[model samples]
Target: MTQPAKRTKKDKIGSGLKQQSWILLAIVLLAALIDYIWYDAHWVIAKSAALGACLSYLSQAIFAGFVFWHTGYRARRHIVRQMYRGQMVKWLLTVFGFALIFITIQPLSAPALFIGFMVMQISHSWMLWRIG
Candidate 1:
């Protein structure tokens, strides 16, 4: 009888990371598309685009937090490690900081706000390429 092939740990990790990167990429693309359409239709003002950009930034920050948590746990097998805690705190701070910036600048530069969102999406795509 022939035996089924077995997957190695590296293969499993690679596949998982690939799937995660793809999902993240998809989210970024969808958010960008929504922002673009809204802006083109004048459904939202520049300030609103800035607000949306802030939301996208916060979303990415949250995703990074989750990634750190999982990667730390998998690498060290300790959820309470200092690195994990530090990353969590950083993630929270990043989200808050970007949100504050968005609110403060949205009313001043709505088009710039939309540009910020596009930059973030591009950055995410670059990161995914590096990681995946």
Candidate 2:
């Protein structure tokens, strides 16, 4: 059989970025839909779940933004430093996001909220698993 065509660094990076973003969205939406139907959620529960999932998605988006933003860098030190900064930024963003959500939204469903957040976070494993 013929070998697959080799991908350039740009192609590889772009593919993974797009794949993960699209897949993450799909997984979260599917999960939220399932949650809504299974729980027969009213507006409060449904809104809480959406907010939680949005926070989770925002964290990953921050990480991906920082990582991809520096792909043009040639220095290894710069790349490593940027990655470290990305982790810190992601953490801070997550904390802020959760705080903001909790502060603004009343009568939040902790169980549903966590379920949405955790489900989105756990999707990363399946994404990586498909690669290896």
Candidate 3:
């Protein structure tokens, strides 16, 4: 009888990471919806919204980390290089960019933020599917 091939550690880790990414994506979308629909639009609620945004970004970072790690790529080194090279500057610019838009446009920020969360969730889900 022929022996079965052994699965690599990378494959195991990738599967685990994929599962985690999906769960995080679901949580992010659900949280965003709940905050939008039922939460009071007060300072405390805004704090909670910010917390959710940070969590969503953190999950995206983790998903990226897992993708790089499983593929034998230097994830943190690449992120650092990109940050120093230009991405961080652009990211900072966008922070103020969105703030300005939020202030001047007024009505667009809520939907825009929710859409951003959805985009992140979809991207994470896609990455997970790729790894799986």
TM-score versus the correct structure, for each prediction: 0.33, 0.71, 0.29
lDDT-sorted candidate list, best first? 2, 1, 3
Candidate 1 lDDT over residue span 11-90, tens digit each = 44445445545544554455457756775744344444445455555556555544455442245554346456656765
**TM-score-better candidate, 1 vs 3:** 1
Better of 2 and 3 by TM-score: 2
Candidate 2 whole-model C-alpha lDDT, 0 to 1: 0.68
| Model 1: per-residue Cα lDDT at residue 19 | 56
lDDT of all predictions: 0.53, 0.68, 0.51
Candidate maximizing lDDT: 2
TM-score of 3: 0.29
lDDT of 1 at 56: 55
Q: After superposition, how far is residue 104 of candidate 1 from its true place, in Å?
A: 5.0
Top model number, TM-score: 2
Tens-place lDDT digits, model 3, residues 1-132? 988544435555556555655655555556556656776532333333343344455544544443344222335576456445454544564466456546764334365365555555565566556656
- For model 2, how does the per-residue alpha-carbon lDDT over 1-132 read when each residue is reduced to its tens digit? 988544325454446556766755665566567656877644555666667777777787677667655544355566678788999998999898888888888878777678767867776556545554
lDDT at position 107, candidate 3: 35
Task: Name the 10 consecutive residues with the lowest summed lDDT in model 2.
Answer: 5-14
